[model samples]
Target: MRQHQNRSLKERLSNSAFCHFEQRGELPCIVVQHPGFTASLLPQGAQLLSFCPSGDTSWIWLSPTAEYQQGTSLRGGIPVCWPWFGNADKNSPEVQAAMAEGQPLPAHGFARTNRWTLTRLYEAADRVEIDMSLPQSHHIQSVWQGDAELTARWILTPTSMEMQLITTNTGQSTLAFSQALHTYLPTTDINATRIGGLSGHPYIDTMTGWQRKQQQGDVVFQGETDRIYLQQASPLRLVTPQRTLLIHSRGSRSTVVWNPWITKAQRLSQFEDNAWQTMLCIETANAADDWVNLAAGANHCLSLRLTVE
Candidate 1:
């Protein structure tokens, strides 16, 4: 029996607002709608496709250029990058390592490109809960050679959304990996928006020769901005003309902020180059120097929440 079997479906969906499976575009999806919030999930990659709160625009950004084809990573929304985060662009990146030894790597790992099983969904008066998992299997073990299982859970309320990723080592050997909830957030104008609560924190500017610098104030964008801010747990605020977004998290040691700006934006599928001003990415992560090492039979959980004010 699977370890997740211990939790029955009835108990899991007892408080769910409403859960159903339906076709979304070209893919089959699980859709959840409650009083003030609505969300959709694709079992492929267990990807979160959309999230919206009543009276507010969609906070999660799904690229118009994103491909829905199976086994491909969508350019937007929250692509759960596991066993690694981002591309192995740098020499000796953490995603290419395991148990102190180098291992094969795929950009953002294989989690987001594979299918996930829906384990449970719950409907409640005020919130909806969802659970999806990818268990250890021959194909999964073949890719990373780690006997592990991954589970993703989400709780959505009228005004907020939360997601958690739990990984357990089911093999006899210890396993190590880095990960992120690469959340693509929407905005009215990327250039005019400012991110507060990270002033004075240090970050690595990935595009500027990977230079390390301390923030002067709330982060603002003028051009291409791709940075990894280390060890900042304070809530993040996105100030835009139309609305304000509050992003909070637990079990996160790093926050990555990115916007392809003009140059890189044109290279993405399903994304219009000029549309760069419409979205920004503030990811929750344990990447680079902060990878996790799990002992056999052990588990770790990473979580995040989003609210609008």
Candidate 2:
């Protein structure tokens, strides 16, 4: 049955000029080779693994040792954190209360590990667009009791790559969730990497007992860092020795900046010990004190746009 499905998917996607199905170890993925850029996307979790614009190196950072197997989350690109971000116990009460009693909650929810259904693919002279949705099935029912639908869309153009995460409440009651576009970007030198547009904003320092502190200047990497900046209002500029990337977001009031540095990098899966020095995460999020509550039949959309110069 699995083989038949793979064959059908391959035939269907292969008809497109720029998109086709390919196997990556134990997993199946779509490879898009548009005139503007090239991208690799996995239906599993609807995860994007790589994006390289024409004439430039990859703006997205994927792990060298990342695994491509069933039931395992890849270590890089943009992981769609959904339903709840991080520890369920740390989420807002409304999000926590929605989970089934005594059900084991995985970090960053279950969206990233489940296979999503491809819903749409459209190509044009200058761009390509793709959409995938999380199917309601045993995977969802096992962890959640509410009825909600998740749809992710991507648009690739010569100058930018954009993503939108849309959540709809299909149940009769209200729905609550936290989510993030956990984007990992690469840097040739971590010491020279700096993030702008967050000065004076307050952040929760998760590594320092979750204390709240103010951002005094452009955020720079020094050691193991995990922070959730609150009430963010502007786009973030990531300046590295390799290139400059701009991150613009909507429907997000928080941004998570993280790097495992050295010590924790040794313990991370699908990551090399020195990988931390070359990658940093600037997540556009609705997490920590920022969460979403949707009324019955309502929908919410979180979007992120990435451009390099």
* The candidate that achieves the highest TM-score relative to the unseen native structure: 2
What are the per-residue Cα lDDT tens digits for candidate 1 across 198-305? 888888888888898899889999998899998766588989877888888877788999999998888877889788998889998887566787889999998888
Per-residue lDDT of 113 in model 2: 90
The C-alpha stretches of model 2 lying farther than 4 A from their native spots are none
Worst 10 residues of 1 by lDDT: 1-10
User: Cα deviation in Å at residue 150, candidate 2?
Assistant: 0.7
The numbered model that scores best in lDDT is: 2
TM-score per model over all chains: 0.88, 0.98
Query: How much is the lDDT of residue 160 in candidate 1?
Result: 84
**Model 2 alpha-carbon miss at residue 98, Å:** 1.1
